[model samples]
Target: MAEIQEKADSGKGGKKRAKKMSVHLDMTPMVDLAFLLLTFFMLTTTFSKPQTMEINMPVKPDSEEDQSPLKASNAFTIILGDDDKVYYYYGLVEDKPELNTTDYSANGIRKVLISPRIKSNDKMVVLIKPMDVSRYKNVVDILDEMKITDTKKYALVDINDADKELVASKTGG
Candidate 1:
């Protein structure tokens, strides 16, 4: 049978050599795996919405006579009473009062002042000053309001003036 098989060969050879072929891997599976990984990453990424906080930022008084430099075009003045009522006033030095409202709470101060300023001009600054005896929460509320209204330039007014010092000393400054 071996001799018959040898004779069946069309070509004569000393020793037949096996043919060699290149190996290839299918790339479709690899591409699918890459896409799956990409999808997982896309889904896992965290998207954070913007947030806000309230703070007491200081403002330089326009002059010693009155703390109204804080009332300048870029200032925001807020007074809180012992009764917990809040008095908020804001406007440019030259312009009429943009906002003046006394709320039983600090709910709408930012909505009234910050929103208007932001929509009016991107370069606007709001210097916030809370009165003495004001609740700490009032300051925080104002800051939260500013963040919501997108007020960027904000400052606190420190009571360093002579009158403020006397008042603080008398009332536990």
Candidate 2:
């Protein structure tokens, strides 16, 4: 609501001038309406739900001896290192594991995961070993890559001494 008032001043002489008008705006109603709209929008609008990646881990057995050994032929290892570098090898690390370096791009790790041999082989297993220097996002990116490639069998394992040695030698770290 707004109100206008005119002020009349009596001069020293008898000369009369135009009265000055002042306007006062009452903003209580406007403020109340604004707050009401704010509350209504806050209550009605929905916030984005937190997104999550699903990872299915194997159940632990009662005895360590009960676990079966993973076949080297069916295993594919991916090592995550610093500087967004990825190293992969087929089967186990032998005298000289044929390690190949790649990035997180589609033409890199994705291509290797979807290769004819790896994709066609139903028993193919992906072992992801993230080094201490690797970022958490790298692990998430690799997991997303696994999902994108439709890789069914994958495990997150600790980087072993052999893997460390191979990475050091290949990366010249």
Candidate 3:
């Protein structure tokens, strides 16, 4: 708000002189506008909540070693390799078990994870083995797939010698 107040020719030699004026500015509307903008931003903006994934880790045995062993029949092994290559097989690599190749797509790993065999077996466990040549993104992708499939039982284990030999025989490395 603005206003101009005129003083009635306050000069001693008042010979048809112009009126002296002073301007007054009110800041109430500016403050109201600021508050309105603040409230609008506060109400419309979305606050980010801290998101965390629940990781199930095996507990260390105090007296004896880990007694409960993972069942072989319900194991689903996934191997990540170079050039975004993904391989998988059911159970252990028993002298060159067919290493099926798949990608990190909806039709690739997702379909395999949500297959009928996996869904039917309630105790199905996923074993993710990332090779030295594979990128960290591959492991993250597999973990995300596990989350998508609602899988509770899974492990990130190192590649064994038998697995390496099987892979070498298949890839002719």
Candidate 4:
């Protein structure tokens, strides 16, 4: 509780007593000032911007001009198939390149991409070939994995007919 007190000495040669008065402290102005400051800060405060991946889109060619081919000898290909299955090959897709199966697990595709042989190869490139039956999330997951693994030299390639036939033979589809 707020207390106001006044003391006086009414003895011989004593002065007059101090008048007792109630202290009128209007908290309304202080509360209004606090609310104004809060509102001003809330209105002027900037929110953190959302982060996004920066992808440089290729400009369409005027005509079908031939471009330089990718080096298959120093390439690692990943083919996304139905049911979230991932097939990969170390080098070029030969007449019957051995297709290894893996998942999107922490120890699955991550292990392969982070291997010493692949990681140490500065000239190695990753080719991502997503099939028609594959989900859109499959592409996003692989792209995220590439970013997570720090694989910069990568490209999104179309699944060729040979690769389709090979996948069909393996998947029995």
Q: Compute each candidate's TM-score over C-alphas.
A: 0.42, 0.84, 0.71, 0.67
Pairs that collide in candidate 3 are none
* Candidate number of the best TM-score: 2
Tens digit per residue, CA lDDT, model 1, 1-173? 01111223447667885544444556787889999999999999998978744355466568888653433555555544334555544554244343344553334554566465545765456555566767898777666666666666766655334323333444453
Task: Give the range where candidate 3 is weakest over 10 consecutive residues by summed lDDT.
Answer: 63-72
Which candidate gets the maximum lDDT versus the true structure? 2
Off by over 4 Å in 2: 4-24
Best first by TM-score, ranked: 2, 3, 4, 1
Between 1 and 2, whose lDDT is larger? 2
Clashing pairs in 4: none
Q: TM-score: which is higher, 2 or 3?
A: 2
Considering only N, C-alpha and C atoms within 3 Å, which residue pairs clash in candidate 2? none
Displacement of the residue 53 alpha carbon in candidate 4, Å: 1.0
As a whole number from 0 to 100, the lDDT of residue 59 in candidate 3 is 82
Q: Write the per-residue lDDT of candidate 2 for residues 27-86, one digit (tens) a residue.
A: 999999999999999999999999998777788999989987878888899999999999
| TM-score, model 2 to reference | 0.84
Q: Candidate 1, overall lDDT? A: 0.56
Candidate lDDT scores, in order, read 0.56, 0.92, 0.86, 0.86
Point out where model 3 deviates above 4 Å. 5-22, 40-46, 63-65, 161-165, 168-173
